[model samples]
Target: MWSRELEGVCDEEYELDCPACGGGLFVAFGSYGTFAAAGDYVGRGAVGEEGRAELAPADPDRLEGVGARLHRAAVGAGRTQVARALTYVFGEGRCPSCDVVFSVREQVEQR
Candidate 1:
């Protein structure tokens, strides 16, 4: 199962004003390091069900607080099953700097 966990803050905190409307937005670490939320961690995606476990923290960045242990019983059990894993945890939007619509990846792929 895939779980949404907190990592850390962005290396560089950036504040950009929307060129279209002059609205400003602060780009910082939301709840998780990779996620960027203006209000809450609406980016949490549950990889396990009630009484079920979630995935173990495979990455060091995800070992913050009480990490989840995901059971494999849920659907989409592998790295190839990313789309299902990121269903709720992520949102697609355009970059404030470049105005490029990009898919914000939830998991940091190991090289």
Candidate 2:
């Protein structure tokens, strides 16, 4: 496998093509959360008291494992394929052309 990383945070969303329907797939990133910050309920969320928390749909089986972590890592790195921005969770997206939900990581074709 090749190494992928972005030098800095990205301000735009990245794009990829869906394998199922050749639709546009937007990339997203993960957030940082530490249990030390707030006991057991520590999580990544909006900083402001008024802004709504951003979220993404995730694989039900990988919700707490590598699959989930990979999504978060990609987001945290500020890049999905090269170097860009993302925040949406897995179940967070739908293909405009096919109207398919991003429930599985394999839906999008990696390039």
Candidate 3:
């Protein structure tokens, strides 16, 4: 097995081509805070507010975990294989419908 890491405290969203049915799949990455600050909650408030009110962006160098999810649609445009900047989670899967090949690239947690 290989290692994977989150880029930073950011939300990344994109559509990927489904290898099985040639359909469209939506992939999203949720905000990832630093390892030391993972359980802290961010609340809406003034920038200078103390405690949870003070929101500091996540640092990739100190990250440990990231949130992500994927969804499939019945009717959507198909996409071809291409190289592009994408946020990849640490996992692998295949197209169930078409029995096609799909892969997740090797990644390292930034921290």
Identify the candidate with maximal lDDT: 2
Cα shift from native, residue 92, model 2 (Å): 4.0
TM of each candidate vs. truth: 0.23, 0.37, 0.26
Sort by TM-score, best first: what order?
2, 3, 1
Question: What are the runs in model 2 whose C-alpha is more than 4 Å off?
Answer: 1-12, 27-55, 59-62, 67-89, 107-109
Model 2, residue 74: what's the lDDT?
A: 69
Checking candidate 2 for backbone clashes, the offending pairs are 28-86, 29-75, 29-86, 29-87, 30-75, 56-89, 57-89, 57-90, 57-91, 57-92
lDDT of 3 at 34: 14
For candidate 1, the per-residue lDDT at 71 reads 19
After superposing candidate 1 on the true structure, give the runs of residues whose Cα lies further than 4 Å from its correct spot: 1-89, 106-111
What lDDT does the true structure give each of the candidates? 0.29, 0.37, 0.27
Cα-lDDT of candidate 3: 0.27
lDDT of 3 by residue, 32-85 (tens): 211111112245541221211111222223324432121111012231111011
- Better candidate number, 1 or 3, judged by TM-score: 3
Whose TM-score is higher: candidate 1's or candidate 2's? 2
**Order of all candidates by lDDT, from best down to worst?**
2, 1, 3
Look at candidate 2 and tell me the lDDT of residue 42: 23
